[model samples]
Target: MSHDALFQLGMDLEAHPAPRAERAAGPRSTTQTEDTIVAPVPARDADDRLDHFIEKQGIRCAGAHLIIDLYEAERLDDLPYIEETLKTCVEEAGATLLHIHLHPFEPTGVSGVAVLAESHISVHTWPEAGYAAFDVFMCGDAKPEKCVDVLERAFRPSRTAVSELLRGREVA
Candidate 1:
């Protein structure tokens, strides 16, 4: 089938809502009460071009943003460590790291960002609460999930909550 045909098929599938049972059986819920939905996107053939499909489908951006909450993180106050881990996460996600910047608060806590060719990964820590907020956004062929392992290993949070969003989706 042509790229436009395949893209149209995907749009048609998305337009129809899934059955309640199918939606409920998606990814398990974390500490948060809300259940995460995992809808399957139609796969492209080997010869199909991703950019063409996205363009034909009126998709503004092929990207994902992962909003993560790290509770009881062990190294919330470690600036250097957080910076290194952010860089590592970008690398592990197969994203090219353009630059990294970190700022340490007066007494404790840290904030950092790792700019990537795909997008960016950032974090803000609150040592007093033993918590950290992370935003991992990536576009193109980069896999954002690859950075999850790095965050878990580095922070050692007692409880982690994650919410993912497909950014720049088709409006109509």
Candidate 2:
């Protein structure tokens, strides 16, 4: 699929929202800047927010999705080391982990997920190529960006790249 199919979500960037929620008092008013629109939601009781969507960069959405790549990396095929590194990433990201499951592939590659309360961190490795790809998606207060640093440090990659997507951005 093309970049537009992946990120744009059929939203016309220049269009303004037509309907408004019950307005907020004080400084919690809505505003628009550039391509993003910011709107304040009415306060809800703590028990009502079970899914943990968050407000980021003025847009309310599900979470941050980080696409991470590691090149010229080390320890790509080590199962135990991969598990440890993922645990470290979850800790460093401040995400609550529920479980970790990893599988080692033929000849020597690894794939796994660190399931978290907010979301998950998944990895797929190509040991022969000294490359690894990771996806870290989490909601709430979990610092998904921190995982990029942890992965780089743990793998000692000569080259690293990351991209972020605001998941559920169309929910407005």
Candidate 3:
């Protein structure tokens, strides 16, 4: 490998591991139950250009998908608002909502996941801690930032980190 190639390889090895949920945890809400539905948001072809952006960003993966995960949420009552916020974002971007789930908590907010054909969006909130956790995965013409706006409006998290993953990798 050339010097630049070797340097690039070294950088990849140093990146931190990504977060993933092993299983859904936390208290379940009774007011609103877990729901799964399919609502595809329509988008213009211009949105299909995400593949080029991903390559330009130097991401190493097989397909185009952006996953956004949020942690340390402090509210659950904000679930409705969060959902509306996300829907607004998805609609604005012309994507679809394949499925959506919202569970209301005891004194605070809600925990749920909006499954999109493009990918999915999830959230967990803790009012006592004044924090919340969220995830968004957008593929193809899907726009993930729209969901993020809803999350920010509901949780107002002080800190957040984003991870971009390339799906459909074939290992031989």
Candidate 4:
């Protein structure tokens, strides 16, 4: 579930205790302030694309080279196989895998970020709904598209949406 939904559910359950309606309500915490406890909410603006958002969020895009967004994989459950398969594909493509991150499934989605020597590979999966998203980026001679093809073959999803990008270029 989304953070909001989970928080709301907790509040609702606390508000209406089961079986014992006469039970006293829990004490409210008055010490927490939004500014002190929470990260600043990002203002929604027109230019909130992935790169821009990443930049705004203070995340360093490893190599500032290639960025590929692959959406519509089968799910997160297929990751172990995908990881093994991707290892071969990445090796063949000349990219080195530094690390892999697999996040828990969320209401928005289950996403994972892979840190790579050439760049990075990020995967997000929704096994319950049979959907996933992936990213492979690299610098120098690493062919990220090969990784994408391997993912496509492994997942065999209904459809795939891809966005390939070359980052860090400047206007002449």
Q: lDDT winner among the candidates?
A: 2
lDDT score, residue 147, model 4? Answer: 71
Q: Tell me the RMSD of model 3 versus the true structure.
A: 13.5
Total backbone collisions for each predicted model = 0, 0, 21, 0
After superposing candidate 2, which stretches have Cα over 4 Å from the reference? 1-51
**Which regions of candidate 4 deviate over 4 angstroms?**
1-72, 106-110
Residue-wise lDDT of candidate 3 within 1-172, one digit each (tens)? 4433434443331233222331134222223234556655555486554332333245433334445544554344666676776677667655667677777778766677777655666777667776666666565556566656666665666766666555654322
Better of 1 and 2 by TM-score: 2
Give candidate 3 misplaced runs (Cα > 4 Å): 1-75
* Tens digit of per-residue lDDT, candidate 4, span 1-172: 4433534533433443333332344433222222111123244455542223123124333233333334445545754665566576667667656565554444445555556556667766667667776667776556666776677677776676676565544322
The models' CA-based lDDT, in order, is 0.72, 0.79, 0.56, 0.53
Q: Give me the displacement of residue 1 in model 1, in angstroms.
A: 47
Error of 2 at 3 (Å): 32
Query: So what's the TM-score on candidate 2?
Result: 0.71
Q: How would you encode candidate 1's per-residue C-alpha lDDT over 30-105 as one tens digit per residue? A: 2222222222435667555332212213456557889999998888888778877887897788777767767778
- Cα displacement (angstroms), candidate 4, residue 68, comes to 5.8
Worst 10 residues of 3 by lDDT: 21-30
What overall lDDT, based on C-alpha atoms, would model 4 receive against the true structure?
A: 0.53
* Whole-model alpha-carbon lDDT for candidate 2: 0.79
